[model samples]
Target: MWFRLDLRTLDNPALWEASQNGPVIPIFIWSPNEEDIMPGAASRWWLHHSLEKLGAKLRELGGKLILRSGKSLQNLKSLAKNTGARAVYWNRRYEPLIQKRDDKIEDELKKIGLEVKVFKANLLAEPSEVENKSGLPFKVFTPFWKQCLKQLNTEKPLQPPINFEKRELEPESCNLSELNLKPNHNWAQGLEQEWNPGESNAHLNLKLFINEALKKYTEARNFPDCLGTSRLSPYLRFGEISPKQIWHAIEESGEENWKESQYLTEIGWREFGYHLLYHFPHTISEPLRPAFNRFEWTDNSDHLRAWQQGQTGYPLVDAGMRELWATGWMHNRVRMVVASFLVKHLLIDWRHGAEWFWDTLVDADLASNTQGWQWTAGCGADAAPYFRIFNPVTQSKKFDPAGSYIHRWVPELRGLKPPYLFEPWNAIDIELSAAGIRLGQNYPYPIVDHSKARIRALKAYEKIKK
Candidate 1:
């Protein structure tokens, strides 16, 4: 069995059910080209550690996660030939490029007289299964989520199977360093400290969240400074945690409180993203709303660099970006604001920001990144209206509130007052000097004027309306 995102054995439908039929052969392909699609260096480092943990877990179960390099199809064919394996099984992938590649491989494997099976392991509901009354895929999230909830009432999550027949194979596994990713890069120290990526850690985190944090998730999720939201996105993205297990865990909690409802809504949002991905394949590259494609985007590399480095001079936006760069994760609220600044304030292409997130975020999944960036750019289904631009200063004051998150990521501003935390440029000479802050030296001036950029973006978008 070949594993893509479905990394864990527990609650993994494809792995569990496949093991029941015959001896299971787990495989993971480490392809450099594919890795380049997203998560350039930092993500690769995380993958290296994740695969290590998964391999260790599989070994304990009398199996091994076979690591290989090169094109997935070529590698699978070679493995099948060496071991005389009869079947190739894997979870499905929905991105534009991956879907095409998988389809080609499926055809080639079938032609070579091997049975190939694809399982729905990534999402809660198969994207194709949820459709509107008219038999068309939904572009809006509300209707899509409602349909997902309806389907969940019909079918629930599957547990990990413990009864797979152990298969023995001496297939060659590649060493981690053979993948030739940029070595000597240790920029992800904070990410390593913040996240433990593997099946055991994922499962433990889920149990803890269900037991403790979930109840307060409803209120805490909105506040960036609070640890209210389930920090399970990276695990979910990597398939270390299954959505079915999460679904069942929440149900088993049995409190049925409003917080549970809110938490489930977030899961629904995850489904909504996959549903959009399935329906609109082109959304991976193209805009969901075609008119937005005509909007003029400034090719301001300096501003983009500032945003990426978290030096945008807007505390909230800078903090979020810095957090992502440092820890490969950021709060959901700040994600929205920083994304808004890129697309609406800087007037850069949303794809640019999305690509950066793809490279940096541990939680970066194709569907979520696509949905989020498109939503911010007003180019996605159920996106905010094109006119709504987030004011970064106000957003910082609202979400961070006490400047705790800002100070944590932006230590240079630790001693600044709460009022000026959002806008240090407003500090007078004495106050600025007292705080040891200099506008352009200690911290950046706001790269783009929010009010001015808002009007420019609106005008630029207006040109596309006609």
Candidate 2:
């Protein structure tokens, strides 16, 4: 069995089915060509550790995870031939390039008389199964998610199968370090401290969420100060935990309100993202709404750099960006705030934020990243209205009421109180002095006037509006 995205032994369709037949050979091929969607630095760090833990688990179960670096097809063909393997099984991935590659590989393997089976282990519902009444793929999430919720069989998730024995004919493997997945620089310390990427941790996190956070998720999820949102995103993105497992877990938790809960709706959004990506693959690079193609983007490197480095001069935006830099993750509401500031406030392209997140985010799924940026920019299918610009100060005040998130990330403003905590530059001389904030020095002044930037963004949208 080949493990692509699905990393866990629990609720893994490909692994469970293959083990049922007979002894299974588990192999991972690191294809250089996958660099297009290859994990960004933060994700690579998580993948490195996730693969390590997975290998250990397999070994504990009396099997070895053979790793190789080469063209995936060639490696698969070579390994199958050497091992006398008749069949290959793995979970499905939804990335356009990955799907194309997998399809060709499957066809070629089948031609050579190898039985290839790919199962849906990533998403709760496959995009093909959840469609509009007209048999068309959903462009709007409300109807799309409603369609999914109607079809959800949340009672039985695939059981976690027993461990399997290793095959006699084992292939030569390379060390994990040989893949060079970890960054060369000493930049991973923060990410290392923040996350534990493995199946065990995934389960633990889910349990913790259900125990502590689920009940308060609706109100507290928006508050970056609280651990209100499930941090299961990275695990889910890497397939360390299956959505089915999460679905059934919610059901079994006796949380009667889960069906109507905001947490479940968040899960639905993930399903919606995959549904969009599968049906309209080109949105990865282009705007889904064609009108956005003509939208003028300033492409200001300086402004973009400021945003990236957390020197954007906007306290809340800077804090969010800094948090992302320090840890591979950022709060969801903060993510939207930073994304909006990039596309609307700075007049930079949404693709810039998408690409940066692709590199920096540990939980960076291509579908979600693409959808989020496009949504923030009002360039995607069923996107947020472009006219509704987010005021970072108000958002910061509302969400991180005590300014702890900003204080934690932007330590320079830690001593500052509310209102000024959200917007330091607006504070009076005595307040700025008492807080030890120096405009354009310790703390940056506002990058762009919020009022001016909002108008600029709306005017840009006007071109595409007509």
Candidate 3:
């Protein structure tokens, strides 16, 4: 069975069922140039480690993980031919490019007389199955989520396949070093400190989050400084964890707090995103809301560079962007604020931000990331209203009231009073100097005035309103 991104076996419907058919030869393919398709350097690093762990786990179970590279179809065909394998199996992936690739592979393999099977294992339900009463995909979230709840008759998660007999298949695998992915900065040090790769780590993290953090997640998730979230996004994106395991665990935890509702809703948001991707494949590169195509974005390379490097003179936005650059991850709330700052405040195109996130976020799933950027930019189904631009200073005070998160990521401002840290430009010289704040040195001045930018954004959006 070929595993693309789904690395873990626990609750993996495809992997578990494949073992039932016969002796299973688990496999992973590495494309040297495919790292470009990955979310970012940190994601590639995580993939390398996850693949290593997968190999070890399979070996322990007396099965071997075959590693191959090059064109996925060409590589798989060669492996099948060499082993005289009759069938290939995998969980289905929903991205347009992936769907195209899989279709071609299925046809090629069937013509060669090999049984090809694909299973739905990633999402809670097939995206196409949860349409509205009219059999049309819902563009908005609330109704879609409500429909999803009605359709779910979830089963308990499956245990890891423990009884697999040995199978021998060893083809050349890519040397991890050849992937050419490494952080250009020191940001990923914390990522290494925080995350452990593979299925076992995914389970350990999930259990830990459920046991200690789940109840408080609704409150704590907004603060970047807190351990209020499952931190399972990367694990999920890499397929080191399955959604079914997460679903059942949440169901069993039975927490009756607002946090439970909040976290589950967040998961629902992910489902909503996948649904959009499955139904509207072109939405990846095109705006889901056609009117958004008319919005005029600025061609300000200077502003774009500042935003990318997390130096936009807005502390909260800068901190969030820097955090993403350094660690390849950003808090959910911060994701919204920073995305707003980019598309609304800076007037940059949403695609530019999406591309950067694709290359930087460890948890970058094409469906989720594209949808998220579009949602923030008011170009997606049920997107945040375009004129509802986030004020970074206000967001900072509201979410990180104490400036603890700001101090952590924006350490140069560590000396500032909590009140002024969010907007040091307004501070008296004495206060600024005491806080080690310099107009362009200790902390940057606000790049663009919030009120002015908001007006500009509204005017640009006005063109599309009709």
Candidate 4:
């Protein structure tokens, strides 16, 4: 079994099929060259631990996972030659470059008379399976998801294989440490504290979300202070759990109208992101809407730096950036606020924000990352309108009324009260002194005035509109 993103044992169609054929030689080839964009630091950290967990699980089933690096084709050929393995089976990945590479590999393997099979394991529905009334890929989410809801696979996920017929010849394998997936510095300490990356933990988190947070998800999810959202993105990204498993788990939850639940809609959005990526691959770097190609964006390094370092002086934006830097994750609502601040308030390129998130987020996925940044920047399919610039202070007060979320990540502002907490510059000298704040000293003043920034962004939008 050639493992790429599908890292788990259960519901892994490729692994199950390979096991049924005969003795399984599960191999993971660490070929970064095959990836369109290399996995980021946080992603690599998660992968390192996840691989350890998967190796242990396979060992329990009386099998070993072979680890190899460099060209996938060369490694696979060498392994097949040594083990006398005649067939290759694996799950699929949907990234543009990875898909092309896999197709070429499959063709080459077939030429050598090796039987190759690929199965869909990660997404609930293949991108090719879903379409609009005209039979073209969807540009809008509602109709696309409505179509998907009709055809979504209701089958229960496959159970992990109980029996393992280990091959007698163990091909030479490299140790997991040799992959150097983990970072060299101590930056990953916060990530380790916040996450447990593995198949088992994925299920546990799903169960917790179902029992504790599912009902209140609609309202509570907006508040970053509450643990209202399911923290399962990284797990899904690495294929520790399949979307099919998540869908079935909710089905068995006995929630009334579970299919149309808000939580499921979020899952549908993930599917939608992949759908857009598969159909409109150029949108990975370019805007889906052609006019945005000529949209002028500012090149302010200082503003970009402030937004990245969480020194934007906008409480919510700063808090979210710091949270992402510290924990390798940020609340979804805050992500929009920060992303909008970058593209609209700062007028920096959306690609810059995308690239930064690609490096920082543990759950950073190409399709999702590209879709989200473009959406926030008002450039991709079904994107937020460019005229709708998010006011960071307004969003801060609305979602984080108590300021608890801001306090947690931006502790320097913890002393400020209601109005001033969200916007410290608004505080009177007495209030600022009472709250132990000194604007531009410890806490930063607003980097760009919301009223001014909004007007600037709108004027820029006018250029494209014309």
Candidate 5:
């Protein structure tokens, strides 16, 4: 069984099918050359631990996971020759480059008299399976999701294979350290403290969310201070947990009309992201709407650096960026606010923000990252309107009424209360002194004036509309 993202044994169609055929030889190949965008530092840190956990799980089941590096096809061929394996089975990945690479690998493997079987395990519905009445991929999310709901797979997820067998002589496998997946620097301490990546933990997290947060997910999710959202994105991205597992768990949650719940809609949004990526692959680097290609963007390294370091002087935006740096994740509501501030307030290209998030977020997925940046920048399918710029201070006050979220991240402003905390620059000199804040020294002043920036952004949008 060739494992890529689908790390878990449970509910893994490829692993199940491979086990039924013969003795399974589980292998994970680390071939960064096959990727368009290599996994970032944070993602590699997570992968290192996840692979270790997967190896342990396989050992417990009386099997071993072979680790290899270099070209995927070459490694697979070498292993097939060594083991005399007749077939290769693996789960599918939807990134444009990966899809192309997999197709070529399948063809090469077949030429050598090996059976290649690929199964859909990551996404709830395959991108090719759903389409509009015209038989083309849907551009808008509502109609696309509505179509998906009608043909949603309601089958129970497959259980882990029980009749597992292994070859008498195991092929030589490299050590996990040789893959060099972990960061060279000591920057992963925060990620290690925040996450435990493995199949078992994924299920435990799901259970915890269902018991503690699901009931209030709709309202409480907006507030970063509250544990309202399921912290399951990284798990899903690494394929430690499958959408089918989450779907089945929700169905058995005893909630009436669970299918229409807001939480499920978020899952639908993930599906929508992949749908857009598959149909409009160019959106990864270019805008989906042609007119957005002409949108004016500023080239200011100072402003970009300020936004990245969480030194933008807007408390909410700063807090969100800091939170992402510290935990390798950020709240969904704050993500939109900060992304808008980058593309609109700072007038930087959305691609800049996308690249930064791609490097920083542990849940950094190409499709989701591309879709979100485009949405916030108003340049992709079902994008937010360009005129609707986010005011960081107002968003901070609304979502974090008590300023708890800001206080947790940006501690310099923690001493001040509500109104002043949201915008420290507006606070009186005495208030600033009391809070131990020096505008340009400790806490930064607002990078861009909200009113002027919003007007400037609107005028820029008009240029594109014309």
Candidate 6:
């Protein structure tokens, strides 16, 4: 079984099927260049640990996971010939680059007389599963998700395989450490503190969410300070846990109304992301709505740098970016706020921010990442209007009402109070003195005034509204 993103043994169709057929050799090929966006530093860190855990699990199952680093096709062909393997099996990835490469590899392997099969494991449904009466993909999420609900399979995941014949031939393998996934410098302390990568932990996370947060997910999800979210993105991204597992688990969790559950709707959004990426492959780098291609974006490196480093001067935006830098993940509500600020307030190209996130986020799935940035920039299917700019201050006030999320991340404002926490620039001198915040010195002043920036963004959008 060639494992790319699907890391877990449970509910892994490929692994289960391969085990029943006889000797199964689990091989993981690390070919960075083959991917359109090479796994970023943060993602690589997570992958290293995820692979480690998977290898340990396979050992317990009485088999070894072969590790290789280089071109996937060449490595797979070489390994197949060396081990006399008869079949190749894997779960599919939706990214255009990967889909193209996987297709070629399957054809070549078939030519060499190997039975190749790819299973649908990551997503609840395939990208091509549902469409309108016209046979065109749905651009709007409401109609899209509604259609998806009708086609979803409720079957339970396969029980994890306990035994498989281990390949007798000594398949040449590289040390996982030699893959060089982890950074040389020790900069991942926060990520280490926050996440535990493995299938067991993935299931545990789901259990914890159901116990503590699932009941209040709708109400408290908007408040970044609250632990209302599952924080399962990295697990889901790496396929340590399958969507079917999550979908089934949530169904049994007994929500007030399953169809209207906000959390499940978020999962639907992920499906929508794959739908867009699969149907409109070019949107990975270009705008989905062609008019957005002509939209002018600022090339201000200084502003971009400030946003990247969490020095944006807006409390909510700064907090979210810093949270991401430290933990390799940020609250979902804060994600929209920070993204909106970048595309609207700063007028910087969304791609720059997406690239930074691609390198930084452990949960950065290609379909979701591309869809999110383009959606924020009003350049993708079912995009928010470009004129509907997010006011960082107003968002901070509304969501982080008590300023807890801001203080947790932007510590300089820990001593400040509500109204001032949202807009430090307007704080009285005495209040500012008590908080020990010198706006221009310690905390940054607002990079762009909200009222003025909103107007500027609106005018810019007007140039493309036609």
lDDT (C-alpha, whole model) for all candidates: 0.83, 0.88, 0.83, 0.92, 0.93, 0.91
Each candidate structure's TM-score, on Cα atoms with residue i matched to residue i, is 0.95, 0.98, 0.95, 0.99, 0.99, 0.98
lDDT of 1 by residue, 1-466 (tens): 8888888877676787678787777889976565326456666766777888888888878787789888888999999898878888888888767788888999999999999888887777888788899999988877888778778642466655544345454678877667654336678677778888898898789888878888787788988888787899988988888877777778788756532398878888888898888788788888999887777889999999999999889988888998888788989999999999999998899999988988888887878999999998889989988799988888878877898989988989988978888888887788888888888997988988877898898899889988
RMSD of each: 2.1, 1.3, 2.1, 0.9, 0.9, 1.1
Which stretches of model 6 miss by more than 4 angstroms? 167-169
Runs in model 2 lying further than 4 Å from the true structure? 163-169
Please identify which of the two predictions, 1 or 4, would achieve the higher TM-score against the true structure.
Answer: 4
Pairs of residues clashing in candidate 3 = 39-358, 40-359, 187-326
Error of 4 at 222 (Å): 0.8
**Model 5 score (lDDT):** 0.93
- What lDDT is reached at residue 72 by model 3? 82
In the range 178-267, model 2's lDDT, one tens digit per residue, is 999999888899998999999999999999999999887889899987899889999999899999898888877888777767888899
Error of 4 at 121 (Å): 0.7
Best by lDDT: 5
Per-candidate clashes come to: 3, 0, 3, 0, 0, 0
lDDT of 3 at 465: 96
Q: What clash pairs does model 1 have? A: 1-25, 11-160, 39-358
lDDT of 6 by residue, 1-466 (tens): 9998999999999999988887788999999999988889999999999999999999988888999998898998998888888999999998989999999999999999999999999888798878987999999999999988998886899888765655455689989999999987767888899899999999999999988999998898889999989999999999999989998888889877866789889999999999999999998889998888888899999999999999988999999999999999998889999999999999999999899999999998899999999999998889988878888888988899999999999999998999989999999999999999998999999899899999989888889887
Q: What's the CA error at residue 314 for candidate 6, in Å?
A: 0.9
Residue 257 of model 2 has an lDDT of 73
Tens-digit per-residue lDDT, 286-377, candidate 5: 99999998988999999999999999999999999999999999999999999999999999999999999989999999989999999999
**Candidate 4: tens digits of C-alpha lDDT, residues 1-466:** 9988999999999999988888888999999878989889999999999999999999998888899999999999999888889999989888899999999999999999899999999898899999888889999999988999999876889988755646565788999999999998999999999999999999999999999999899899999989999999999999999999999999999989999999999999999999998988888889999999899999999999999999999999999999999999999999999999999999999999999998999999998999999999999989999999898888988999989999899888888878789988988899889878889999998989999999999999999998
Tens-place lDDT digits, model 3, residues 386-436: 889898999999988999888888888888866788888888999888877
Superposed by TM-score, candidate 3 places the C-alpha of residue 135 at a distance from the truth, in angstroms, of 1.0
lDDT, residue 211, model 3: 95
